[model samples]
Target chain A: MTQPAIELDGVGKRYWKIQERSLLRSLVRFGPPNKTELWALRDANLLVEPGETIGIVGRNGAGKSTLLRLLAGVSRPTTGTVTTRGRIAPLLSVGVGFHQEMTGRENIYVNGMLLGFGKSRIDTLFDEIVEFADLADFIDTPVKFYSSGMYMRLGFSVAMHVEPDVLLVDEVLAVGDIGFRIRSLDRMREMHRSGTAVVFVSHWLQAVQLLCPRAVCMHRGQIVFDGPTEGALARHHELLTSDADSAEYARGTVRVENRQLLKLDGSPAGTVQQDSAMIYRVELHFDESVESPQVLFQVYAEDGTFVYQMQTPLGESWRTLSAGAIATLDVTFLPRFGGGGTFRNVVVVTSIDTSVTYVRDDGLAYFVEPRIGAAGLSDLEAKIAIDGVDRTESRPMRFGGTWAAVEGA
Target chain B: MNNRSLLISLAQKEFRVRYKRAWLGVIWSIALPIFQSAVMVFIFSRVGRFGSGSSFNYAAFVLAGMVPWLYLSASVASSTTSIVDASDITVKIAFPRAILPLVSPVANLFTLAISVLILFIALPIVGASVGPRFLFVLPAAVLLCAFTATLGLALGALYVYFRDVKFMVQAVLLVWIYITPIVYPPSALKGAAPWLDFNPLTGIVGLFQRAVGAPVPSVRALLVSVATTLVLGVVAIRAHHRHDRLFVDLL
Candidate 1:
């Protein structure tokens, strides 16, 4: 019923790579001077509803940062339009626009104002922000004297309290220690509950999978794929493998002919159920005779976190393979991740001599759909009846989802 | 609070940070320009034999013109370079990019205000008594700030595109004082006297001199300063508003 919080209509941005930035050189460089045009984004169209959480994944030059800059209104789109309702907050890194000489308390007002919050708003939120940052003792101390973690915590706390309609978080969640990271995630989850749209961009696939339900995969300045988070991640891993394989394949002796993910019933599986067995099967063709070879299998979550790893038994010597031989390797595992998410499985083949690696393949990916009312990286499913008394139960959640918001764009 | 409060807050930060770790603190704001004025008063009045036997005290003349001159030069010099200097914030955060340049001039206002206070107090010490005519100092200060902000916003916006403008501003400010008739009255110059009347700051300094009961500048010079400030002010606001959202690209 409500208008989407943010919309980009045919948005495009281009930057010039000037050969010489100086005024004098530019004057002397004559007609059609030395410069190149780089289109950072092209025809980027997106619409985000309120309380939607969207993830952006891309390689280095895929223009994710440029898109954020445009959405934040820090940079204007060269063409097209970016329209958004209400305030847009860019979850900037620590000390952005902060005066280091000012105390944490002072910086909060200044930073909050710079981010477009009223002074009275910051005043009321000040104590809660301090408690959240856990910097009660250092509130009056100059930020320059605060540790980097403390500085980031104070920054994160103030931004978290702002109640933005749309929050653009760019890899700022990995701040502080693990505890702070979790707390920050929890706070973001809270914002999600209260109806804020979050545009999160991160290379950490696991975090992306944990938080965002939908994602857009960007490649070479355009959205190559946009759908469920797992599908986007699967597409991304394929891009990475294909990108990496082209340069490395020329020197390898063994080639991965084909790769497939199969269920326990031996049917090719594109998506699997939670707690079901999955076989990461790779077909390899050898160009040269090889002695006992070891095969390595690794599973990575959509956030690129290594979820599982195993290898063929170290001392179990498989028979030698003559030249022009084909080998089929199967890696079996039970997908323990709950709630549907993408997982990438890599297959590597190497000789026992430890001097040569035949092939390293990471192109295969599969999805696991978690059970109802389940969450987190794994489905522990802790169930017990201790002497006829049971206490394990989940109360009705005020926040309906793991992260309350639904992400798009 | 709105941008008005944000502007004041930002300026307050610039003011506080300048004195943060220094032992001399706000004293430096008063001391540095006073020290410069004292040295100039000695050199031009006694050593160079300028402004001698004049109806006004050369010391008061020098100190009065010196305070505003210092504010103009320092504010312009720093504010021109501010947008580029704070690229870290400019690149990441989204707000009015003009705020970056606007903050420094306002931030330095505290120092300018403090120095002006020191000037009023120093006037009596130099045998220049306070007069009701000194009320003109309020308009003079406003005119001075208008001139500074116009120039600052215009050049700060320019500096984002052409970084070498920073050095150009510094080079100009270094020589601007000598030409503004701070130590000697504008009448002291010969052929350049007519040209000096065209310099916008000439009337500003003249007004500052009048604020402390020194010699009055011609009406033409005062009119020129007002016209120039308004014209440049419009141009600056236009330029900055057009480029405000685009400045981050260059950074």
Candidate 2:
């Protein structure tokens, strides 16, 4: 492996919170007064070897952005030290630093220089950057007119062509379309293969899993887990679902006082296999009386898009569930979602109308790392036949669309 | 081979694209101040309100002042907001923060050059004799540009943190021309002449007027202008060096 391209030893950043803006009036306010203190990022540490692609995953306000900003040199750490070996390029949030009045060609030069290239070097690489952006015709036009996709294309092209020793990517790939995203990821992968130390920050666990073999998970300005991508993801899921203490208590006509995933023999199965049938047992504590309660549960894909939802029998009438009555509900489904990423399970207890929910829990996110080469949301068994030859499909079934044989009407 | 060429290629690219859409093409740079000079010449000649003296043509007087004033105002106004305005690229990519401020002054050089050319063309028409004294405007132009960029870089950095700086700059520029002796002669100040020496712009305008053989400024005022330019330039560079990479965070 190449030498360590980026190193941080006990590096931490502290920001001041001004009690009030230092405006003329505010500064002269009664007796020179206001308070300020340090917040966010203290005593953080990490080291990255050259050619290593590392993913950083965390919830909102987790200081993930703070860490990325430090890596990019956007802001310096208030304490500790950061040392980098060579030219560093940051592909931050989409199309940063582009001047609206400037054309694509002009921006590329300006951008290339900003990334630490001298003028002559940029001239030689100019064509490559332009070609990568696919903006041959629009290169001379003002970037204000370029669509978001074009802008991103140009930005990434310039960054990649700079041949940076260390590349910092911050959730910018989330904005592009699928094709562009694929290309950008391919370029990033190529960079990794060519010995560029990479640090990528994203909320998408799937994206993290796809690009980074090694990953770290952050929570509340602290590194919760740091290891292999798969292990980090598993720990992240455990943190999300091990609701020993969750503030988001279920609220509905019947409040879910407790919920647990269990094995077939009535033992709690905290983690389930990707292909095994499992039972999700929930206990609802009722406050007021109700006629019928429709308990709903949903599983979400890594990107937070809904995977599927199920409801209990709708028409079953129940006697008034008085206050202080504890009822148990169980749901069993074969774990079939195909893609190997984190999936969140949410349970909501509602009235028969399904409009006024008494208990709702959206915090329990689960991780499902499907077998290798599998894809999409589900693993439904199916076969394709062409000219009497059956094509046994190996990939998992992605969400949406289906094929079938139908007799003539 | 590829690395050193980026700066030259970018500067050329920016210069070419700036005038790509104009009707008169690159001539628009010269045309703007020349037209303004024509209007000033007509108004002052007919009205005789600018305290004209026999030594210098009022037409040439106004053109000289307009040249530096245009360069200073345009450079400062644009440079103050250059980084913030180019936020699209600054926030995403890693680059030297100085490039944003650098682009404006570099681009404005074209117009500054045009104004100087027009200054010469207007000189003979306005009854002024041209001589080696014309070379004096070169140093004066250089000094003026140096100061303008210094102010631009400094103000641009402040602008990233304090958004109100842009409006404050506009407000100052609105009142700046009157104080600079651009439209009228410095002698008109009379009793207030001593205080006028303290104003940095007075020396610059005095230098331009001197090139045209107008009443040359006192030595102290000229020294003050040169000193202010050097001081402001130093301050701007120091501030930018310290805050260059961090500017994007505030932006």
Candidate 3:
């Protein structure tokens, strides 16, 4: 059997959370010192074979970003070690290391070298990078003048051209238009097919499902689940819908004393699909007196966009909810709203008609894997036709060819 | 893998991008400092009556001091901010973090070389005889750069964590000009001159003056400066090697 391209054993990182901003003040302070230690990751172990596409799914602050940073070798592991055999290319946040004053062409060289490319290799791949970015004419203009889409496109272009042996992709794919997003993903797939080990960190489960056969889910700096993408995602969904899901947050005025995603018959239903006609009944037990109680539920697409929101009637429903009272609110809809990815629901209990919020239980994520050739978070049953003749119904419409290979041609 | 070549390439990149937008282009590097030296010559000779001695033409004297002082100050300022400014790049890519701070000295070399050449031509016109002794300026310049690199690398690495190192360097630089013997001859300090030898840069400036027929630095002062530079250089390299990859986390 081939050796794993990358290996991590008991890896961890510790951060000193400095309470004071200025360095001078810390020199003399002796009383209860203003500092805290945060273990961003601990005892994490993984072995990835070459060409394996692994997805990392977790809530915010779950150490997903920290794991990517470690793999990129941008920071040393405070404990343990990480070993990798080939060149690493990290597609971090949007416009990572791009100089605003530099033109697109100049930035390519700078970025290329930073990613461990030799000058000769950069020279050979120069035309391909520019062509992939589709900024043929605007290459000479300063990057500051480029739109946010153009900037991200250029950054993604450089990363893809490096032909990295190990690709570390953070959620930077969330930016750019839908078209470019699909193109970049296809490019990543091409790299994966050619034996580039890939680790993708994203909150969107659909993107993970589509790209990664295996995945790992992190919770509070620990790997909660690791296996097939479906199993990891199922555990992730359980973490979202479980009774103990978001109640663990230490901050905030009101705590989700209790939460339940129930079926119409009041039975616990942990799994919900994209096309299921399911009623999402969210019952929140508040710990404090929330005046003019308004429970808000927002659903996000795989790309992290606000696809839709459902809130209890603003002025009319559940006024002045007393402390310790269980406020069971229900949202029944035809689950056809999302396209095909992981959808996260943020259950927020706020003061009606005011910006003041009382309780928020985040990280309630679920998976929605629609049938083949579906688009986006929810299938909105979008029908396109010419003079009443349905295009999709009659024949599979070609939305241009696959974007990666045919891009330059 | 080849650090020297990578450093040279990074340095070239820094120079190209820095002046890419200027209307006068790369010539601005040569023009701005020459203009400043010209102004200093006029002030000291005409208004300040700042001649160190009758035999010494104040123009040549001021040019010697101005060129090196400018090199030191500009390089220091650039080095202090180098890591912080390149935080964007460092946080993403893996390379020698020291390359960021080294960029200042490398780019400033162009302007530094020009000033040295200008001083060479002005020596005879300003009443100083030119000889092979002038060749000492080459080693002196090299020493000055090595010293700056050691100091800048240490400070730039430290500043990533402490953050106050940048401002502290700024404050020290403001007062450092007066103490470095840049604007006056070492003899002008008189009785205090012996103690002032402790300053590392004092010996460097003294070396430049010595090459140009000014007073040779006391043996004690020369030893102190060279020692300080070597010690600082070793400490800086150790610190950088220890903290190179970790610096990006803070950035």
Q: Encode model 1's per-residue lDDT on A151-262: one tens digit a residue.
A: 8888888888888889988877756887888788788878887889999998655567667878899988888888887778777766764575454454567877566678
Ranking by DockQ: 1, 3, 2
Which digits, one per residue and each the tens of the lDDT, describe model 3 over residues A141-204? 9999999999999999999988899999887877888888878877886887788998988875
lDDT of 2 at A321: 76
Better of 1 and 2 by lDDT: 1
lDDT tens digits by residue: candidate 2, A1-409: 5567877777776665555443464536886456555546767778788888888887777788778777777677777787888888988877766767788987887777778777678889999888877899999889999999999889988988889989888878777677777677678767777888888888766667666777887766777788877777766667666643465564444666566776788886644567677787777788777768777789877677898899877657765677778888787877787655667677777777766777667645666655434567886644568888976554322111110111111
- Which pairs clash inside model 3? A206-A341, A206-A342, A338-A377, A338-A378, A338-A379, A339-A377, A339-A378, A339-A379, A340-A377
**In model 1, where do residues sit more than 4 Å from their true spots?**
A176-190, A256-274, A281-352, A356-409, B53-55
Q: Which has the better DockQ: candidate 2, or candidate 3?
A: 3
User: Model 1, DockQ value?
Assistant: 0.64
Q: How well is candidate 3 docked (DockQ)?
A: 0.51
CAPRI accuracy category, model 1: medium
lDDT ranking from best to worst?
1, 3, 2
The CA-based lDDT of model 2 is what? 0.75
The CAPRI-style docking tier of model 3 reads medium
Please give, for residues B1-251, the per-residue lDDT of candidate 2 as tens digits: 33334434554556776677777877776777778777876777678577455567777788888888888887788788988987766655555666667666777887888788878877998788787787878888888877787788788888887777888999999998877887778777778877878878888888887787777878877888889888988898888789877776666
